[model samples]
Target: MELKVSSRSHGDHTIVTIVGEIDLYTAPRLQSEFTRILDESTTTLMVIDMSGVEFCDSTGMNVLLSAHKRLRERGGVLEMAGPRPAVRKILQVTGLDSVFTIHEAVPEELLAAEPQA
Candidate 1:
């Protein structure tokens, strides 16, 4: 489908809304986007908005995992936002629901999350 990365600031954190299916074809692009952001050293927290992702295959899950792993090692964190029921089911079945921080698409006070040092 289509992907849109919306950047916003909540205190010192950066939120990016990802709207699309992150399959094999699109995963690479998303991966690259993360790498670029990481290199910039401007984003301390990355919130991937999965609210618009209608379908996600294993490849897509892997993409998210890869990003999480990378961020963890780098002392950063990547969070998931607004996953639909289908996608949520897949993540829960795979036991990734516990690993990732999931949030509803609501108005929350985005505090300045700490960066990995």
Candidate 2:
């Protein structure tokens, strides 16, 4: 499936909404999207909206980790929102649920209002 990425920033936070299947074939596209968002301006918090994700694989998980790593390198952070149950389970089983900050697809204003960890 095709994944469409949309991005916007509020203050120092940039949020990217991901809609569609995320697999090896589309992970590169996600990476490119992130690059573009990062290029738009300086930021320290990145939020990924996963409410529309239909399917995912280990490759998709790797993409998530890469995003986290990318933000960390800049003393920043990446948080995922509303991951589907299947993907959520995958992340949990891989012990990554604890790695990526998660929330219900809320706005950045209220997102940080409640920290997952």
Candidate 3:
């Protein structure tokens, strides 16, 4: 399936939502999106919404890892949210689940407004 990627800002975070399969053919698109977000945005936290991802191969995984590494090098953070069962299993098997802060969903606290003093 074709890959779709979109990004938006939420508070101090930038959320990138990705849908469809991610294989060797489609990984480049995702990588490009990540590169664009990292280069264009100054947000310290980047959360990848993987709920719509149906499949991911090693190339795709590498792209994610590279993005995580880049963010870390810049003193930023890379997180993942709502990965499907199959993709979750890949992360677990590859030990990436531990490398990234995995969220069941984009954390509500990030989306919530700060209480006025």
Candidate 4:
């Protein structure tokens, strides 16, 4: 399956919606999208809506971690929203569940109102 990414701005944040499998072939696509968002300077809060992702591999997790680290370095944040069960489990097993601020779903304000820790 192919990876698909879409986005919308929520005030000072951007919500990126991703679908399909995220593996070796698709991780770059996601990384590219993140680069574009980071370059555009529209928001500092990057909310990834993974509700449509069916599978994610180690590469995918690496991509997420890289983005999370980059955002944190700049005093920004990377958040996961509505991750599928498998993806959630990977995050838990890898101890990354604590690294990211996760939400059951993308909240109304793109979670900007909440403190980013």
lDDT of each: 0.76, 0.84, 0.91, 0.88
- Model 2 is weakest, by summed lDDT over 10 consecutive residues, at 106-115
Instruction: For model 1, give the 10-residue run with minimal summed lDDT.
Output: 106-115
lDDT of 2 by residue, 74-105 (tens): 89999989999988888888999899888977
**What TM-score number comes out for model 3?**
0.92
| lDDT leaderboard ranking | 3, 4, 2, 1
How far off is residue 56 in model 1, in Å? 1.3
Pick out the ten consecutive residues of candidate 3 with the lowest summed lDDT: 108-117
lDDT of each residue in 1-117, candidate 1, tens digit only: 776555665554667667777777787777777777666665556787788888888888987888788878877788888999999999999999999899886326563343434
Candidate 4 on 1-117: residue-level lDDT in tens? 999998876567878899999999999999998888777765778889999999999999999899888877788888999999999999999999999999999986645664566
Top candidate (lDDT) = 3
Q: Which scores greater on lDDT, model 2 or model 3? A: 3
Q: Which of candidates 3 and 4 reaches a greater TM-score? A: 3
Q: Which tens-of-lDDT digit does each residue in 16-109 have in candidate 3?
A: 8999999999999999999998898887899899999999999999999999999899889999999999999999999999999999998887
Instruction: Give the per-residue Cα lDDT of candidate 1 at 108.
Output: 60
Better of 3 and 4 by lDDT: 3
Clash number by candidate, in order: 0, 0, 0, 0
Poorly placed runs, candidate 4 (over 4 Å): 111-117
Model 1 spans with C-alpha error above 4 angstroms: 9-11, 111-117
Better candidate number, 2 or 4, judged by lDDT:
4
Residue 94 error, candidate 1, Å: 1.0
Q: Indicate the TM-score of model 1.
A: 0.81
Clash pairs, model 1 backbone: none
